[model samples]
Target chain A: MLKKTALHDAHAALGAKLVDFAGWEMPVQYRSALDEHHAVRTACGMFDVSHMQAVDFSGARTADFLRHLLANDVAKLSAPGGARYTCLLNPEGGVIDDLIVTRRDGDAFRSVVNAGTADKDIAWFQTHAAAYGVTVKQRTDLGILAVQGPQARTLVVPHLPAALRERAFALKPFTAAWEGEWYVSRTGYTGEDGFELVLPHADIVALWNALLADGAMPCGLGARDSLRLEAGMNLYGNDMDETVSPLECGLGWTVAWVPEDRAFIGRAALEKQRASPPRRMVAVMLDGRGVLRAHMPVRDAAQRDVGQLSSGGFAPTLKQSIGFARVDAQASAPFEVEIRGRWLPLKQVKAPFVRNGKALV
Target chain B: MSNVPADLKYVKSHEWVRKLADGTLVIGVTDHAQDALGDVVFVETPAAGRKLAAEESCAVVESVKAASDIYAPVAGTVLEANAALADKPELLNDAPYGEGWLWKMRADDIAAVDRLLDAAGYEAVLAAG
Candidate 1:
């Protein structure tokens, strides 16, 4: 049986089309996906990301354990409510998963990982954590709600806990604050100002109803995927996997090659590939009117294979199709994508096709 | 179940074809196919005067979820492709059988339309699988 979230019934009430995603029954869309995409871009939208796993690491040596596991230095998350986006890499420098590690109060560290890789990630964490005497506990009790877009913060604040409203508004981007079990973060996958709330399942259901009553559109995974793509955020399996490293997938910035002595798990492999990376990533927009779906082959003018689309789809805001192509490190601009055996021109552009409800590319 | 208009002949691939008085045929995806495709964003129809073989992937319909290839129901010469889809692809979702008609083609053999499934037969295809 497919696992259902606490809000599965709510999705059904909204007439959502549920599909199995990573072994969980989840809403792909409610009505029109395009409208939901637009709603998030222009106003406010909410997504039930309860399926994603939030694992808490606690122990005396939690800081030291994270430093040894993640590619990005955990030392930067020095204070409570601090957060860092990093990737868990295998010894060979390939990405196991990408996650956000938040520095919680005391000896606890809260990290949210993709739903599809949660189980495997817990196993990996358990394997590496035992040496440092850390305990890996998954927080299945929490339901994550991401309210994103221009008005996300405004629309969500009035509903926050009475005491937390002021502090929640004061939280800076990439930061989080907690009051008991209520945690609010000023971070999002969409390139928009927003709040991601982690609340108890029972509390979350109430909030969902309140938000809907107040006109916050309840979006689904369909809009979430497009919003992230437009925001230029990488999806775990689609963009990077066990086969590719951070350098090859436009995430070299996430790697901390500094401090010199931090012997992270994949440091040696990253250092080896640093001088001459085999693959590189590029952002492409179809010059013509057509959708670019994942797995489509990217080619040079001569039709020689360059790479493949990691995440590709229609950009509702731009009214054009856009995607990310993981091409050869040596590959240059003016790429072509093979669609139905036809070579369609794809123009290379700087990433983040949209941010904060504005077009960037 | 979406509307399967009895006046139109259907293909297992979910295309509905209508035989016009001039022996030309009008084609578009069925209401069921449109519902399955979600919000249509772009539709690429064949250019006028293009020739198509039976089962040829002659056009494309792109939704937010994914892109689907629209195959030709029978061998035909394209008369005119819908110009409105260029600007408003949502027509496919809003009116799959009317304003969303993909193209007009003169069939190589008008008998090809009779060979396609009627509404009841197409309903059976939906039922079996």
Candidate 2:
């Protein structure tokens, strides 16, 4: 049976189209997906992200444990309220999952991981944490909601309790704050100015209702996927997997290489592969008709297949088809994607095609 | 509730058919089909003069969620396709029965339309699911 989130009833009430995603019965779209996609781009939108797992770690060795557990160094998060994006890798230098770890204090940190990999991620954390004398607790009592867009903060602050309103308003990008029972973080997957609120599961329904009353459109997984893709963000299973290294998956920036002696998991394998990476990830825009979808073959000018699309779709913001592909490290521009037996040329460019409601491509 | 026009004919595959005065039949997916498919992003209709057999998959309607095939209601030769959908595929969602029509085809046997489902039959197909 597929699991349902706290908003399952609300989604059904709103006439949402429910589909099985990662074994969870989640809303794929409420009304038309195009309208929801445009809402986040121009106004603000909310999503029920309660399925994502929140793993809490608290102990004297918590920081020390994470330093060894993640490819990104936890030392950079010396200040409270600081959050860092990092990759959890297996010993083979392949990404197990990409997640965000935020520092609540020196001894307590919270990490939110992808829903599909929650069980495996927790198992991995538990297995390795025994050596560090750290306690790993998956907090199922909490529910998460992400409100993203240029006006997200303005639209949501008024709904927060008076004490939390100011702190939420003052939050900086990538930072978080704990106001009483609520945890509000200025982080999002949709490349927009927004807050991801993690609160008690009991409080989410009322919060969702309040956000809806405040004109925050209820966006579903469809809009979420499109927004993230246009923002050049990577999907866990689609863009990278257990066999793909962080360096090859456009996540090298998340890997911290400083303080040379800190031997985080996968460091040795990464160092071994750093000299000659086999694949490189790039963002491409389709110049022809038809949608760019995952697993589509990409060819170089010589008509030789060089790579495949990791995540592809129509970018609502760009009003064009765009995608991320894993290509040969030596592959250059003038690329083509084979769609419906036709090899259509693709325009290669630097990533982050859109951000903060602005077109970057 | 989806709109099921009483005068039109439908197929089990969710496509609706209308016999035009010129004897060519106009085909498009049903409202329920478009709603189930979500926002149509790209559509590929058969080229003019292409031959199609009954129940054959002749067109593709792609949404962000997945790509669905639009099956031919009867054996026919494609007369014209809705070229407008190539640039604005959302027409399938906005007006699945009107501007969203996929193609116009001259049927090999006009009596084939009588063999397809009627409005009530199509509703039963949706209800059974």
Q: For this target, which candidate reaches the highest TM-score against the unseen true structure?
A: 2
Candidate 1: residue pairs that collide? none
Put down candidate 1 lDDT per residue, A169-209, tens digits, no spaces. Answer: 99999999888888899999888899999989998899999
On lDDT, the leading prediction is 1
Question: Which candidate number has the best DockQ?
Answer: 1
- Residue B118 miss distance in model 1 (angstroms): 2.5
lDDT of 2 by residue, B40-62 (tens): 88899999999999999999998
**Poorest stretch of ten by lDDT in candidate 1 chain B:** B60-69
lDDT by residue (A1-361, candidate 2, tens digit) is: 9998888899999999888888899988899788998899888999999999888998889999999989999899988999999999999998999999999966999999999999999999999888888899998888899999888999888878788899889999999988766899999989888999998877888999988998999999999999999889999999998899998989998989998899998999999988778898999998766789999999999988899999999888787799999999898778999887788999998889999888998
lDDT of 1 by residue, B70-119 (tens): 99999989999999999989999999999999999999988988999999
Local distance difference test values of all predictions, in order: 0.92, 0.91
In candidate 2, which residue pairs get closer than 3 Å at backbone N, Cα or C atoms, i.e. clash?
none
Residue A351 in candidate 2, Cα distance off native in Å: 0.9
